[model samples]
Target chain A: MAVNTIHREPPEQSAYRGVRRVDHSPQIFNNQPARYYLMWLLLPAVLLLAAISLYPFVWLIYMSLHEVQLAPGKSDLWAGVDNFTRLFSDKSFARGWVTLFKYSALCLSVEISLGVLVAVILNNSRLEKLFITIFLMPMMMAPVVAGFLYMFLYNGTFGWYFWLLRSLGVLDGGTILGNKSWAMAGIVATDVWQWTPLIALITLAGLKRVPQEQLEANMVDGAGPLRNFFSVALPNLYPFLLIAILLRFMDNFRFIDTILIMTGGGPANATKILPTYLFDVSFKFFELGRGAAIAFTLLLLTILLGLILTKIFEDPTRKIKTDGMD
Target chain B: MTSVTIKDVWKYYGKTMAVKELNIEVRDNEFLCLLGPSGCGKSSTLRMLAGLEFISSGEVFFGDLKVNDIPPRDRDIAMVFENYALYPHKTVFENMANPLKLQRMNKTDIKERVVWAAQMLEIEELLQRKPVELSGGQKQRTAIGRAIVREPKVFLFDEPIAHLDAKLRSHMRGELKHLQRRLETTTVYVTHDQLEGMTMADRIAVMHEGVLQQLGTPGEIYNHPVNEFVAGFVGEPPMNFLDCRIEGAGDSASLVYDNMNLALGGEQSRILETKGAAREVRLGIRPDDLTIEMGTDHGLELSAKIFVTEPLGGDMLIEADFGQDRMTIKRKIAELGQPGDACGIAVNSEKLHVFDRDTGEAFF
Candidate 1:
């Protein structure tokens, strides 16, 4: 094969030529389209959850504005703040609010105290896992099932606990749940029993995550047990304690299924909390508008409580950060 | 500053022995480094000194007082950990001031000490920052400052600079050495890196498999290692050992290899004759001492085919093969031959180390 060779004189280049060049845009999406397509598929599931969970909240706000009369497929009428006006004047609604505040105070105090005690005990022991499992058993039970379980255990004649309490001189001859004076106490006790485990569990996890090095450093610094707990352990546990308060606050308002089943709005509404009152107004008294209004109010209260806790948890270093080396 | 003495110390984990009969004395104002690989009982020994781990046997004395049963806080010792272990929630000032504050010191005194330590560590500007906001080096400085402000009798450092980058680690190593010298506190520093031990330690205690192998100054350990372990462990590019047999007779004893024979050095001649005929011996030579050439010297020369060359700035590491066996040799990268080239490697006669092949004990 002969090698072909050609030679030609080169063309002279222009000094300042402007050429319109095709901007063959870089294929920025160079990878397989399937990867991006798979990511886009997750958006719908997320949106679906937002729609199902968030839509009802919007609807509840809307319902709060209108007067709803529920009598088997009846349409609600637009009464515009009339239900809310009636709620302020109503003594039972006021009583419900008062009772809720009192109950929350009692439940929050007892649960947190009992929870921290349990956590401390668990933290300093080898039997931690065993005690934690035993303590968390009540919390793991469904609220409705837990309510029924307590109902049987607190029943007057047939209940084993009632008999045990009577024998121990902590109770009188008659049933305690039926007495109006003792009704709220029983509810508070049940809440503490069922939910204290949750606080202990959270606090225990917090305690476990506290740096071993920090503790050792403190011990090396000559901090006694009380001083270390106050200065180091307590400050570190602030975030977990904040979480426990917010959780217990939310759960206390939703104490519907348990309190409703156990007390049925109680002897003369003494133990009627916001949720139970909401249930009674809408379903029993057929005042759906007022009930939706009350529910919205409870939601607002819960949101306010959440905001307060968020503020606390959001700025652990706020005091220190603001002081700036003082 | 206080002197520490560990006498026949033993530590056990259930039935397994963690530290076996360890005995060492830290002279007042001396910096002693416990050097070993992981699971070598170095950390355990330090923790026992810190009173973090209980000694299963024997007594540990700080000054004239036996501290075997004293709690860590009452022991009046300070420690810096690998992670820098500062309180993340506390400001740098508070972190440094913590130990002093724990003693219920006056507010003014605490501030003065913390500021003093921060200034010494060149971290005065970082006092307002939290430990989380600080860099790794800054956090480590704060930790050291915390320990320094305590002014304890003894300072225990548990691989404090192991987490830093290479350049920074060297810088901090020098800082630590200078700081310890200034303080003149008896310090027990634990490290797995022999470089840190060599650079910072007044004396290094080499440990292996939960036993103290040798204790001496860094130079002594490097030049006169007691056994195969210490010899192999102390150097950067570890010493290489070759299995050989003694042959010939009388005053003309020589080491015979598969393809070569190396005449024994003058100092080794008597020991070589005592070893007798056909005795197995291991010949050790540091990489820096092995000379590479195209021709033989008075020592045995072996032909090796270069497989790879790693140029490390001034020096080059060559991995070469002698038949089926491979060995690494360090030489000046500029004068090094490329891979696949044939080169003759000669061990410096005066630097050759011989050990009993079975027992692995250096003969001369």
Candidate 2:
């Protein structure tokens, strides 16, 4: 064989490390001609989702701009932003927003504190199964039924809870559901009774997922049980707690069945949350146009809050970031 | 610093006996390694010392203080877990500072101590990073830094480096040994790797099946393993065993196996005369002691056919079929043929170890 010697220097190890900034570029389908076929295949599902969600949303916006007439064969009147503009001066419209936040706050504070306390207690208790079953009983009951049940318990005339609270000197004189100052709390109490277990359940699951090694390591690092919970367990449960709060917060806005059944926005409208007001406007008085306007604002706020929640979830500093390491 | 004494320690989870009568006295400033396979009670023993597990019976002490009922936090001991167990949410600095903060130390002092530990572990740059951002070696170092930052009376390590890769594990062995020496705190380390035990431990307690096989220094464990299990466990290539009979006594004492009758050395004959009760004993010898003599007849320690040969760069290992048992011989020279080649082997009889056939207890 003929002698042939040639040398080509090899690339340095660092030269092809594959570390470079990634810029966004669309590379979905390399086959340009087949891309249309893929899009055509995807069209049915996209249109189905649009029909269910987007069509109704567009109708709501359209209804918000017109005075929706319910009469048979009657033409609807176009009311250019009047229904929306009227909301600025409406006393009940502004109060509804304030009351909604108030109710949510009252419900969240009591639910989170009591739920976490119950979860922590039940976590190590031998009778946890029995107690969790008992606690979840309230959650399983229909919200309207739970509301009526609490209403009876809060009735000043013959209610057992009112009599007990009066005797204990905690209630003083106010009938829980009838009194103005206490009605919001009464509605909040009903919501808490029906939902606190959900928080507890979520927190319990979070507690289980908290790394046992971290707890043991903290103990070995000279933390007592209480300190270990705060130091390690609590941080691990932060994401769970956030999720629980978000669920409960949104539920507070959506589910007014218990509130409407128990309070009916009575006692000077102390518990007239936005949903209750919307319920009365859209259903009781049939002010569909005004209701649609209010509903749009409510939907906007919900979306905004959801965005805030997503931001919190994405916050790098507070995240318990054991991603691929596990 | 304190001396950790585990006296008659036994651990039981329900009916399963994890540790049985493990007695070890780790002196102040000493690095004692509990070496065993998984589920061999090494980790259980370490946990008992750290007060993480309840001892079913007996007592554990840090110096004169009985710590049987003391909780881990109150035991004044620090432990590094096998999985690193660095708090994922906290930065490396906070994780290292946690124990001192629990002590209610001043902010400046906690910062100072944590910084010192960070520097020692070479994790200063990673102090602000959370555990999730760290590589495995970095996380291991952070865990070690967290343990050392406390400067507790006794340090308990439960196979802390077993998660690291081979290169990092070897590198950490030296770093950990030096750290223990510099800190001069009593450390009880648990590891299943005998290499780690032999290389880093001041004294090693070898456990098998939840029972202490032998307790000795590296030299003693290597040169004079008290049982066949210890002899078989402590070495890299591991020791080989063959069933044989000890014939006669004193100068005439010989190991009778297969077609060969090999006379025992003077020192071995004396030890056998004093210790051997039954004539049957298991002949134990390391692969390093047996030399391969290619195409030879004289000084043949039983003829065997080469079953396989593994030629490592520096040394080659030759496995031979000696009667019923396969014997491995490691040598440096490469003047050996392929598999199935006939070879004579010479045994350095002085390096031979004899064990009881029934109980596996060493005769010497």
Give all TM-scores, in the order shown.
0.88, 0.90
Q: Fraction of reference contacts reproduced per prediction?
A: 0.36, 0.46
Model 2 lDDT per residue over B1-364, tens place:
9998889988899999998887888988899999988899998898888878888999998999999999988988888999988888788898899899989999999999998887777677778788777788888888888888877998889999898878778877877887888889999999989999999999999999889988889999999999999999989798989999988897679888876687787878887778754799998989999978776463586888889998887899999887778998988966866788888876778889999999999987
Candidate with the greatest DockQ versus the true structure: 2
| Residues A54-123, model 2: lDDT tens digits | 9999999999999999999988899999999999999999999999999999999999999998899999
Q: Write the per-residue lDDT of candidate 1 for residues B207-274, one digit (tens) a residue.
A: 99889999999998988787888889989788888888887666677887777778876558777666
Q: Given candidate 2, what's the lDDT at residue B245?
A: 91
Model 1 backbone overlap count: 0
In terms of lDDT, the poorest run of 10 residues in model 1 chain A is: A1-10
Candidate 2 structure lDDT: 0.87
* lDDT score at residue A44, model 2, on the 0-100 scale: 97
Tens-place lDDT digits, model 1, residues A1-326? 10111211111244336845676887685765566777689989989988998999888877888876556797878989887888889888888888888889999999988898889878969998899889978988888888888888889978777778878997864676887877788778888889999999999988887777777777777777777777777778888999999889888888677888789878789888778888988889877778889988888888998997788776354444544643
TM-score per model (chain B): 0.95, 0.97
